[model samples]
Target: MPSLATTETLIASSGRKSFRVVFEGFLHLMLLACAVVSIITTVGIVLVLLIESLQFFRDVSVWEFLTGTKWSPLLKPQHFGILPLFCGTFLVAAGSALVAIPIGLGTAIFLSEYASPIVRDIVKPLLEVLAGIPSVVFGYLAVVFVSPIIKSLFASADLFNAANACIVVGFMILPTIVSLSEDVLRSVPRSLREAAYALGATKLDVTIGVVVPAAMSGIMASFLLAIARAVGETMAVTLAAGATPRLTLNPLESIQTMTAYIVQVSQGDTPAGTLEYRTIFAVGLTLFIFTLLLNVIAQWILSRVREKYE
Candidate 1:
């Protein structure tokens, strides 16, 4: 018994509701698909690395891989010790951290707390430009530019040394740490700084004591990510660091990182199913595991800091 106009209104309302439901469901399905895509891709990579590494372990024992002091898998009498690669990786990573953390953190603090709008605008774009440059370019720069300077400064340093690799890798990771850390520091509530200032604290004290402490979780997270990046760097280190795998703490000496060695082996004409080819997978798995632990630790620290703040 409803009027025609009233019936038409009811139909329109029902149609709109139905359309909205369908549209919302479609959006949700798209989001779910995006999420699953990453998980599936990660699973696929892990499976391939795991399976190939298993084949490698059939020929070489895990203990030998973990504790071996030498890593000449391609040599006739193959020595599969991974410790030398680990040492070189750690040495370069440590040196890069030395350079990146301090300089990057200082840059972040200046941008977030001290820089004027004009200065921030100028410096930020410059930093981004530096970051956008290709890693291969950095490697070339390290070889042609940084290596000579390092050799001059440290007379004993080799042209292709761990020191040069560390210096270039440090530059490579600086923007990541600085950009993320600046965001974290800037996101610290202004009220915290004001309160410290109200208590007669200096600008330096307010920044270092209040703002930096509040943003510790995010800053620490950035450092960890930069370290992981340094660890995974292949091209820069491969070109800069010498192809020699040695267990030495001296930055002046030539050495090869795990990633560099992997690159070296892959560049060869080793056939598939050969020991040389399988070595790359084993090295990849080892590097993956090492980087995974660093990420887990970073997450744990970040979570703890977040809990405290909350």
Candidate 2:
């Protein structure tokens, strides 16, 4: 029904629009490709760890690996006791959580409920800077600075020991917990706070009762993440927590975490393809599983809490 010129113009415009749509779709496909690549890479690493761990278990009985207390893979009689490492990891993680939970939660409360815009601007950057410090630097600080101070204080009090590493690790994870928890607290609906105020709730009461409960899921997830970081930390524990794998419950006694033991074996130059070399992968698998379980639990909690709030 249209003239040739009008029909040609309409065809050209439609072609251009179609081309634009295809180009946008291509960009989205590229983003999806990147996400797939990341997932594949993570899966590949887990597979490698699993395969090597299976080989180690083949040589060492599952019970021996799980129940053995001594972790001397290089010694004449190889022992692959995982309990000592578990003990060390739990001790450090527990200590870190004890130290971080209060301070981190307090900081979040201040940032979310108390701090003014100007104060927040200055404080948020400072908190981020603390997180930006390298783990190696934190390790050095624990070894050179914190350990000495802890030794002095504890020696004076007659309480000095390897527990100092736990304290230092706690401090190292403080920033992470604070930053994450604060973001979650800030995300709570303003209307909730307003409702509390209308009900004659004090600022403190509002923050503690309504806001904190609402953000509890995020706060808990942050705590779990902090524990994961503490468990996987290698250099800090290696330098500060001394490599003595004892089955003692005393935090003051020297202990070797799974990560620290891995670093020790790797740095000590265990020959490739030997049992000692394979032990690293085995230890790594344990650490990975521990952190993975924590992450899954954290995610589940967060999802349920978020759904309730939504």
Candidate 3:
């Protein structure tokens, strides 16, 4: 038989273990509830967009809004065409992607494969500092600095054209691309690199042939995230890209994006119930849907990549 003291110690240990289990269960429940809040909030926002957009559609045909060539909702014989907004938005987003992808990818590769720990520690912080800067600041810079430079380069370039806005938006998105991509690259198993090196592969070969392919999903995700950021950016695009909704292919000309339009109208005398004001919800819903599609693609890519590794 065990001694009384030993029996008592065992009972005390059991009691403590039970208490820990109970405490841990409570923590898990709390975390689960916290996670649910974000999902609920997202669903709630979508519902609001849908409800308000439906209210808009009651007055204007969905087909007309989607297919209209002009977007002058407030003018006489108003045309509620979304094409002009979509075109401008796409052009700017594409430009931002062009700027961010190559440069951000290169930065990620350098940080992941080539940089010393000290360099990474210094450079990483500096890159993240860009993200902390407000969108309005970037907008101001776009107008005062970027637009002037572009104008100097091409004498025909208009102030507050797509090019300046694109450049600024791209710069705004660079940090997201670099940070996420670097994390993805760094997540590649060290053993894979070791094995490649053991098989007589050079560092370049391993990085290019092995690490990059392995991290493709994450890199693509980063790119999509950057695209989404540029798509939704308001103040910068507003200040830089003039509010001229048009179907122009030239970067030298001015344009307005969906976000810029919504911002423009929301700041004015738009009372809540008017059809003019309801256009905001419609545009917002479109934007939400576009972003949702991008996120869906990202998730699909992530799943496929995860499957490859698994």
Model 2, 99-175: lDDT tens per residue?
88899899989988899999999998998888878777777777677767776756642122357778778888999
Off by over 4 Å in 1: 1-3, 307-310
lDDT at position 266, candidate 2:
80
Q: In TM-score terms, which candidate is top?
A: 1
TM-score of 2: 0.89
Candidate 2: pairs in clash? none
Q: Per-prediction RMSD in angstroms?
A: 1.8, 2.7, 2.8
The Cα RMSD in angstroms, rounded to one decimal, for candidate 2 relative to the true structure is: 2.7
Model 1 whole-model lDDT (C-alpha atoms)? 0.92
- Each prediction's total of clashing residue pairs, residues at least 3 apart in sequence or on different chains, is 1, 0, 0
lDDT (Cα, tens digit) per residue for candidate 1, span 116-199 = 999999998899999999999999999999999988899988889999899999999999999999999998887788889999
- The alpha-carbon deviation from the true structure for residue 230 of candidate 1, after best TM-score superposition, in angstroms, is 0.8
Q: Candidate 3's residue-wise lDDT over 226-259, tens digit each?
A: 9989999999999999999998879989999999
Instruction: Give the C-alpha miss distance for residue 266 in model 2, angstroms.
Output: 2.4
RMSD of 3: 2.8
After the best TM-score superposition of candidate 1, give how far the Cα of residue 54 lies from its true spot, in angstroms: 1.2
* Model 1 TM: 0.94
